[model samples]
Target: MRIAVGEDDVLLREGVTRVLLGAGLDVVASTGDATKLLAMTLAFRPDVVVVDVRMPPHHGDDGLRTAIEVRKRLPATGVVLLTQYCEPEFAIDLIGDRPQGVGYLLKERVGDVDDFAAAVKRVAHGGSALDPEVVTRMLRPRTVPSELADLTDRERSVLACMAEGLSNRGIARALLISEAAVEKHVTATFRKLGLAQLTDGHRRVQAVLRYLAAQGP
Candidate 1:
């Protein structure tokens, strides 16, 4: 898959490029400026664009804003916003219109080369790969009669993992539980959240976003 990277840190940018290249993915473009990222996206039309949430000048959400614009201008291109924070608000907004081909992952996750490569591939193929912390932070009680309140702790764990765009096996590995247990929790979570009708590979992502969005900004 082809990928474009946008990050202000030159070292990190090169590191990301090397990582993706090492994973056997093509690095079509790389830039330190968020604006350049959008420009490259329009120019290269990469399969996926891995962008840092902050870039150039003020270094606060320039990449995120660009990602949103890219989504609007090039709906077919996949976007993955990398960040140091577990900022779910930006993520929720990224998928406000739709979740296909969008991802939100913590910067630290790059250490796991295999996982990071898989995430990029997933987004390229019209899927998601959210950071687990993003969901956990999003689930904190902030409203009464919340949709998330209906879930048990384990179910919530399953939902959090799902929000990160992990498969049942991935969730099991992360949580150190059996795949059967993870599947059960996923089914139960979906049923409780009324997501049964939307059952599909992306259903968990949709349901998690529904719950997170319900909490409002």
Candidate 2:
């Protein structure tokens, strides 16, 4: 697949490109600036774009913002935001919309070349890929209300997968259930959590984050 990369760190950018090339994926363009990232994305029309959360100038949410723009402008192109550390809030925002063709993974994860390549392929094929650490960090103990506490073990399991950025089909595959059954569980879980049926993508992520934050760090 044709791919583009956005990372300010020169070495990391090169490393990522090498890894992708080694996996037999074509690297169409790589840039150190977020502005160039957007430009290259439009010009190269890559099937997938890998970006770092921190980039030149703002060095905060530039990459995340670029990903959002890409989704709006190039709906068919997939995006994967890489980070040096686990930031659930940033991940939530980066992937809140278009959850299907998006991913968030730690830079350290690149060491596992196989897994990293799998994540890239998954996002390119319109699937979500989230770091395991991201899920664990978002589900830590918190002061949940008695209402939310009523969720069954299965429901909680479903929620955990949801928070990990899994789609209904993904949750079903992970849980070894049919996609229809996954939807049922998801709908039931949402109702138990008092969430609206409209909740999807980032909104669903925010809801999960609020629940986790209420439980405390």
Model number with the top TM-score:
1
Q: Write the per-residue lDDT of candidate 1 for residues 36-138, one digit (tens) a residue.
A: 8888899989999999877864465678888989899889889999878676677887887799999999987657888999999999999999888887877
lDDT of 2 by residue, 67-132 (tens): 888988999999998888686766666666557898889877667888898899999999989989
Stretches of candidate 2 above 4 Å error?
Answer: 144-217
Candidate No. with top lDDT: 1
Worst 10 residues of 2 by lDDT: 194-203
What TM-score does structure 2 among the candidates reach? 0.64
lDDT scores in order: 0.83, 0.80
Clash totals for all models, in order?
0, 3
